[model samples]
Target chain A: MDWNKILLFSILVMVHVPIVSIGQEKLAMQWENVPEEIVQGRLEPQGTASFQRFPQELQKEVREPVWQLSRNSAGLYIDFESDASDIIVEYDVEDQFSFPHMPATGVSGLDLYAMDENSGWQWVRGIYSFKDTISYRYNGIKPAIKGSLRTFRLYLPLYNTVRSLRIGVAENSIFKPIKTKEQNPIVVYGTSIVQGACASRPGLAWTSILGRYIDKPVVNLGFSGNGKLEPEVIDFILRASPSIIVLDCMPNFRDSQKAEESIIKSIERIRAANDTVPILLIEHAGYSDGFVQNERLEIYENLNKATQRAFTYLKSQGINFLHLVKKEDINLGKESFVDGTHPNDHGMVGYAMAISKALTEKEILD
Target chain B: MDWNKILLFSILVMVHVPIVSIGQEKLAMQWENVPEEIVQGRLEPQGTASFQRFPQELQKEVREPVWQLSRNSAGLYIDFESDASDIIVEYDVEDQFSFPHMPATGVSGLDLYAMDENSGWQWVRGIYSFKDTISYRYNGIKPAIKGSLRTFRLYLPLYNTVRSLRIGVAENSIFKPIKTKEQNPIVVYGTSIVQGACASRPGLAWTSILGRYIDKPVVNLGFSGNGKLEPEVIDFILRASPSIIVLDCMPNFRDSQKAEESIIKSIERIRAANDTVPILLIEHAGYSDGFVQNERLEIYENLNKATQRAFTYLKSQGINFLHLVKKEDINLGKESFVDGTHPNDHGMVGYAMAISKALTEKEILD
Candidate 1:
């Protein structure tokens, strides 16, 4: 067709359907691309994919399982400000939709939270579809006050790798990316529970909860079934320049001797590199079956005993800023687990509460 | 020739494998069939399938969705007493293993709880597999006392239809089926939240939790999105001879006028037949995003207001044993929901607490 005919057709279409309002008086939607730099919780800004947890250099340094799990955007999130009443999120993931125990909402789905008038984070509900391309549509979002834009943080999938991501809002509404200021992040290096094994949603993960509570960035280096406190992972964690380092890998250890050695080495290596960064060593949040299973109870007791011994030895060597959290402190009740080993949302909240309380008691957050 | 060959093969197998001890010194396992009479929570014994919630006669009376959802073993469970240190459960399901938001553990999984020394039920953990034949193996179970057998209640799947079920224990351990005594049960009729949507496990559902709290059989008549206040379904609930009936289907209604009409009709019908049984009317548990979404908040408020009006009208009519539970009482904080509509494990607990508090306040459970 000629340019004149195309122009005439466009004019006819415009006349047929008004641009400002549709049949229901809804505003026309506009899509915006999100850049990689605005995404928080990664260890490095360079040498990694847009949503990957690890840098490209660590691909060969860490074990296969750790490297593979790092591809999941567990604790990574994007912060932005928007005035749109309706928010739409579209993303593509590279793996299966969900796990047996964990649902798609936690595995491959996105979770959204907006800042309230009091600066507290409130969860935003979205209607999601997980077909070939995942999409989340949040309707009727209101600002904290009239004529004001609201700040929102969108958490990525907890157990799936994303291929692409984009956000859509009503046309003519303001959409601004919020850059995270340069600050030391709280680094958590742990196991499947830390990586959000059985949480119903991404934002319910313990690390994400802690970040919301403290209003700071928390880097999640949690490798499912592979958080062994290896020297390679610790070296990379040190590079993040973390203010508080948490090592919670006792659940991954079956042998007490190996666990003690790894704990001492991980702490000593961190101390050697940085003198005063607070290091918190967390004992295994014992299996929920520990109440009825003597063998599981024995394993938990032995591992916790090893962690206690490691803490005592490290403190004896004049290691400062070292703290330990016992298994009892986690206090995951019998009802908290989805499986006996992994925590559901209730357990996730419990974990965040205990960790935050310990941080407060140690004056680490101060 | 067949008898001789069979005898020779059995002798050889016995010689190769010891009867009393295995490689790990575990006891010889024995399987026991769970009789239909022993399973609790179904409305009637002879009319329904072993694990079905509704009787066969109601198939023609209820809507198609309601009838189909009735096939799901949402609230059915088995009560038994055993002395074995380990327990195994094997069952088969009829439909897909899970949903997009709810996992297989809450759909087709089995949850076991045993009465402790203080008579409080404690969760028992199990390793589960959801293959063609779903199975759960709970190892190293310890009784409350050294020499006494423990009473265990195993919750069935909350969202899938069970085809068959069986329990396995050590060869010499005593396995006794605990028959549910004839008594008035607490009948709950509601929507997906009551049917255990997005729950991490079966035992975490609100009705199951309430049953444990009250130490009585609680019949769950939740029908997912089809939980409209229909007379056909209400008739089945009345047949259970409920000690207290809970109506929590406000979330399933969108129109306030229609909801008010249905509420008034339902209560009047129940009052027509029975007058002494307590009827608790629950307001809508507001959406988690209601704080930010004015549209959702409006819907919740309108529905709740309609419920309040219905309650006042019914009470003015001199309806006896009537109670109302306000939305403020449920108080599902912003973090309680998985998706905004359905309550997660934390929200489920909140729901149970509110309903049980109302029941206690009204002296219905007394």
Candidate 2:
């Protein structure tokens, strides 16, 4: 090698050393910033995490803590004490399990759940009072409670010594506060699954997951097994004046007749409320039960046919507010579900991914 | 009123009345020719409307009549009466309870709830066995002894009489029938939500829903809660030779650092395996909580920023793919969720609709 060539190689090495070192340094910094709990990729032990504990006075009467809960006119009061500069109250409420005939029964109350480092988990009804120290109330329940649990994971920033806390009822404590103003609300209306039954946590639920991802407010109008494309529900949803309306009711219908008529009627009803507001229609996921035996497969075929017909008709009628997700992409097979019906945590992740994929590919979220 | 005009109109009416009545009669006759169920907007129930009771030997262990059971493999021997036709076996492996995590625990298999004109609501499990007669099993344990109830609602076709039923384990009886060779199959891999949860029925999941719409066989590889954008998972997914790979993990990451880095790495890893497979990336839905206070709104902002950066980077690298759903269109807000998180039925519907809209707009789905 020539002397000049050696000099050039040395310069190149000298310049590349800092760049490589910078990359290593950045990686080290990231590792340092990552929380140890998540870094280990295991469920972290619930430690001294600040949480609202139910007061002894009302503890016995409350039900299990759910991921989401709501109640009609009746206020849900939660009480808690924190020295944090900022705190957030979170909860999950909706009907995912119930009788089909009782369409709106699950909308009348709130679901509440709490977890702290000290206590593993606690379930509570919607009301809590703390000796006039603090209270919080949530009003707006027209549906009955469904699903097993609704969780409330409030984020609080501490500034001083914090002891016990209460959730479920209302609270008026002097904690660091962060003010939030509501903005364009997204509204969704559909079938029972949308009500959220088998979800492990409110955050894991696709709707909740979406909310957390977008960092926006959302109002859920998912009736449990009774999402039958009723005009009454549509009217109520319209009155709420949501920026968008999502219609997914084909799953509840036993066959094509109900799916076809209800889907068309739903489109018309929603269009009457807001002509330009976007309306999305989602098809049911295809089941494999029929695939095993050729006989039951027609059900899915008919559903697809009906959905396509409805979409075509809607598009021809100049109803530009529509979208859809097919069944095959949604079902991951038997292993995807804990049972043959509801999905597991892994299933939910798949669902979110599919929806997200569809959205991105179509450029609806841009 | 003109007298002459009235008289002429009456004369014309008198002339047309008989003809109009005759036409009406013909229309009525045509209507009568149509099936009553069709006229009533319900499809006529088809196939044999009876199920063979399990043999006495099988009944020795069954507590209830198995309504609709399936065994995928041939390990458990089933013997049936020679003349028994249209027999359907239904079993409930576990007692029905409104318990939390029941769906996730796999205790509850597929349940078929049917209504009849005489009796109201009836339910049947999807798995059972036949011995000397027909018997049902609840859980892995057989009933302490055997006695069977008659299933009223579920009907089995006589042509499929003497069908073997399969229940527990991955393979065996009725549910997983023999599969025929296929030349093409679609594979989908994504986050946990895609795995399917909270859907009322197996057919309602978006993945399954999509499959039905497209008229294709799909393999689902959705893992719940475990949908971190890991290179290992991506590599595993690529090995399946899927028709398409959808990336939807932004919501799972708490911050942009993980999302951006992992997304890029995942894409690169996937590309390394299959250079030309269609890759679709999905952004997160708007957060319902953000709609309230707009806290963490920057999460999406950062995600989008990173997405755009990645898109440009990929484009420069000669990679071709699509992005689905936009933040503005699919933001999670009050109207979209029942609680601060988790989409009610309405939210799921909305999500499906958005995905469909994005696909249609982008011409990715016909």
Candidate 3:
């Protein structure tokens, strides 16, 4: 309104919300004002549909064969900067489920993380909803870490669609957007686990955890139950020039030969695209309950064997950039699953830790 | 009932439920049929007040000064056995909460485990209620390890009161109670985390995990927000005559000197009663969010210092049976918490692993 009214408003904001620092003027900006380089999830939006994540053609096509792809936001993150002592965010999520077993946080939530000079990237908080009949809004969250200059990263919804998001800081806080560097994004393509099914929050997903652990940006192309090596999806993945590509889609292959055929084809395409970029292949983290269930054990064994055979065949072809991680090394314990299938947070941590350890030991991630 | 009718009913029981091992007469018994030692947690129950966990006096006294204690079922468990292929449980709980942030599973649930010869203790499943105001029924859950005779350990509710319970097994399965040996019952006395707050299920609690890890009977005496080493509670803890006592009560010790005072008194009493029983004193798991919030960091620093001072005093007193575990060794990350205060499953595992490692290193537990 007026200058005096604006001063009164700033005072009111500081007094009412727990998110403001004294003495410094507060600054507010809409999402559109930020530079595009800071946003990382979607392919560059064109024309009037600039805010949409997927390309129009791909979005329309995905709805035909894989409706799950349109809903999954496995590898989307926005990096931002503000010198304010407090940061606030408001976001709306679409298509939230009321599943009795899986909580809303795992279903549709935005995960926040910050990186400092010493610790690299560390998780800060999750903005979630208890119920979402309409769109979900998370408001008045303040996660501004003091003492060090911080680069905050926000992971988008894991299993839901997002309508819009608005982030704010104190009136006088200096702010800027950080675009994802095109140099070498880590690319992880896998089943629902990689897409972050049943993680208590988006940040706890194994892929997200590994990304933070390795201090790099990650592109998640995981489709809930559709990470089977579709040639079309593979074509899309090839567009992202990543330093390393991780494949963990054996669980979705269903049939052993299909798993083998997909694994071979995807590896071949990736090799053709870039002969030197490291490719990491992961076997299925067989159901933990399978230890007691004979039928479940057979399903695990058959799938794992097929992946193993494909790995052996690929190794014989002198593909020096290829690396394989055995499922046993993942060592998911009986306590890891939320349901006997999708992993809980514990399982996600185990999977991330195992993958990180293997990559480090193999000299692929050093 | 007539003899023919009884025979027909037996045949019907065999036909409907998969619990029947066949060829043997079916046997069903109410919880009262089990011996007192086999049904741990509760003291003797007189008259119709059968499902009571603590003695009337303790429950009454707990509510007087420490109301929170009345609601926590931290360390209660039932030790029972049956040869039945499938075991069925029917349990009713009281004071179920509608807090959306925490689920009924963490609030109140029955955690089941079976000890096998090779694997020690393996989790079978948890019986939880998604809604309030009902008794939860777990039916047709078979946990028979093909080669070994299994004895099941059932951890009681974490935050609710159990009104009654029914245990049923296969027609041919022989069931019996295995008492906590007079020589060693792994005893853990701690705060709410040990009291199993926010754990996805009771079995995932650190105390329960350690019990399974060690393959020993355990007595959990965790009191939420009330584990300040009160003399009355200490007296109750001493009754178990355990081989070792683990103290993890830093969270409840909000005041530093008071914490130091309590730890010394408890250790003194335990040493006086049984000089040789090893007592493992644990420092507080400093808040995961403290890495960002200085106010939170100060609370952690103050509490841990108090516990450390108490440990130092105990060691200086020539209490060779005393041992200390630092919270840093626990290594809980930010994602481990559900809220800023309580740990989810991931934090529980880290806590359990750190404590177990310390105990193993000290040779207190082989």
Candidate 4:
């Protein structure tokens, strides 16, 4: 056995397991449970094994990697109303702290946003400490008015698994979980970029940004590197009763042959389940490194061409409610990416803007 | 005295000490040393104790924290011309791997950019691995023509101290360092934001972004939390023969009185040394959390008001070639920040654009 490797790994884990420390002046607070029904961005919240994306029944039905990745709380957020001037958030995640390209802030950190009476949604910044149990302290949050409860949305980690969660408000303050209606949400089924690859915070993710922009629920079914349009995943997405279904899995396709085949199959399966559901197909946002590497450029060009062919074939079969988002439509500049592949917060903004523009143009969102 | 704490610290140090590994298909190459004269961003390159920002003479003059931070390679980058299709970069940084909010990619990672013959500048994406000796492998670079050498610029780490660095290319490829003329470069002296804090990568820093837009060299003298407009630091700025001097230290000032006094003192010191250099003063870019926190909002408003008073006081004293950038000029939206304090890559773009516009409007840069 390689003791060196084991020793190094153990040390890394120990170092990342931060010791939770509360400052000298601790406020008196009443803790409340996060009601499962109030969680947005999940398709089957009730049937999940924990606070995860997939249902318990589909665990054995999907690929090993897909099932494992489904455990991540990507795009999941809690909606609530609070009158507390100071709030405390505590949660536990079942994964490593961070990645090389992405930070812990986006990987496992919690993001808070409050709805302002006059200025729309505003960000709520807090002092956070990581440990066996992660905690966030938000002090002196201004009321929307002089003295009234304000609506607050707290976004979960984009690339980590939530083990347990709770919220604490000032003693005697009102805290109510906002229950979501059965509205057909805009469903985004895509790759890591959609899963918030390198966004500095959860709210900056394209899906989250789009949610605030259209003022609607956005169900994120983004799987990192495993966003290939398989029947099992598509089956799960169809169950959401989506108002607008977006498929953006072309970047996962290494070749045009696979991309074309998957696009046709995924769309056909979706249409079989619901014939009139509006669907949006997206082309690969070309890599920033494409300018200096011909092979990199060709990957996007070929995938886009194959997508066009699939769209043409589908139209010939008399398929309606299908729309295509071209590469030009996304319009990511050379400076839009972190590592030429994953869109940073800058590129994430571009993604949200592009999707919003497309949906508005198609009259999908008013 | 604390055995458990000592053990934990030792373990963390061992875990971060990366083991350097090379791929199986290693090609034969020749390495070239980075010329110190070609390194941009440092205030003084020739007489530094090492490849650092400050000269050896001022080692005892500045505060301890400022002197320690001066060793960091925040905005440093190397300019060279190469015809090699593949490039390898290797370096060592003397610091912890990363922060809770900022990843290793920004804290200690290297970024590369190549000049396109037709399309201006392009980003060169590379596969990187971190260790005690970190390395980057960039393969299959496309030339302007079939056999032309391209101007390649490699940016160093943003928040770490560079111990050593080296570059490798094909055995017979032409490699040349670009010698910079002593043209008066824009000198930016301020706080952590100006020092490339929390940027996803070095190239995404506002100073680097502004460098590309104006196609001119920019010297960065940002000193983390120690940009207090001390006369010792201001003395170094005057030595740079700056075409334009930008002061953006309002964020570091905790109170309005301190901010107003420091601004006046710093500007006076710079004027006393060099009378005709164009000086631009920047107001604090308000925090994102200010929308929900009145105290946070007041911090920016007070600092900005104090800055305005300082600017007015200077102008009344018959000070010429002085400019004040209002808070509105650098418009950072609520969504612009990463942790409500630091600007992410998206916000970095906004910052660069604002500064570039200010420079152009003042006829400082064509």
Highest-TM-score candidate:
4
Candidate 3 docking band: incorrect
lDDT of 2 at A203: 40
Q: Write the per-residue lDDT of candidate 2 for residues A1-366, one digit (tens) a residue.
A: 253344233222211111112212321110001111111100111220111111222223333321111111111122232322122222222223222111111222223323333432232222212122322233221111232222233321100111222222112222221222234455556444454433433444455444444544444444445567776556656755666566666666668977888889888888877887666677776543343223345676787789888888888988875777777656554333433344444455566667656655655552
lDDT over C-alpha atoms for residue A95 of model 1: 97
DockQ of 1: 0.59
DockQ versus reference, model 4: 0.63
The per-model DockQ list reads 0.59, 0.02, 0.23, 0.63
Model 1, A1-366: lDDT tens digits are 253344233222211112333336666777775665788999786666767899777889999999999999999999999988887777788899988899999999999999997748998989888999899988788876888989999999999998777787877778898887698999999999899888899999999999998887998889899999999999999988898999999999989999999999999999999999999999999887777777888898899999999999999999999999888888888778888899988889889999999999888884
A-chain TM-score of every model: 0.92, 0.54, 0.82, 0.92
Better of 1 and 2 by lDDT: 1
Ranking by DockQ: 4, 1, 3, 2
Pairs that clash in candidate 4? none
Tens digit of lDDT per residue, candidate 2, span B195-241? 43333333333444444345444433344444566554465456556
Docking class of 1: medium
iRMS values in order, in angstroms? 1.2, 11.9, 3.7, 0.9
Query: Which stretches of model 2 miss by more than 4 angstroms?
Result: A1-366, B1-186, B329-335, B338-341
**Model 4 lDDT vs. the true structure?**
0.84
Better of 2 and 3 by lDDT: 3
Candidate 3 Cα lDDT to native: 0.65
Kindly report which residue pairs in candidate 1 clash with one another: none
Q: What is the lDDT of residue B105 in candidate 4?
A: 88
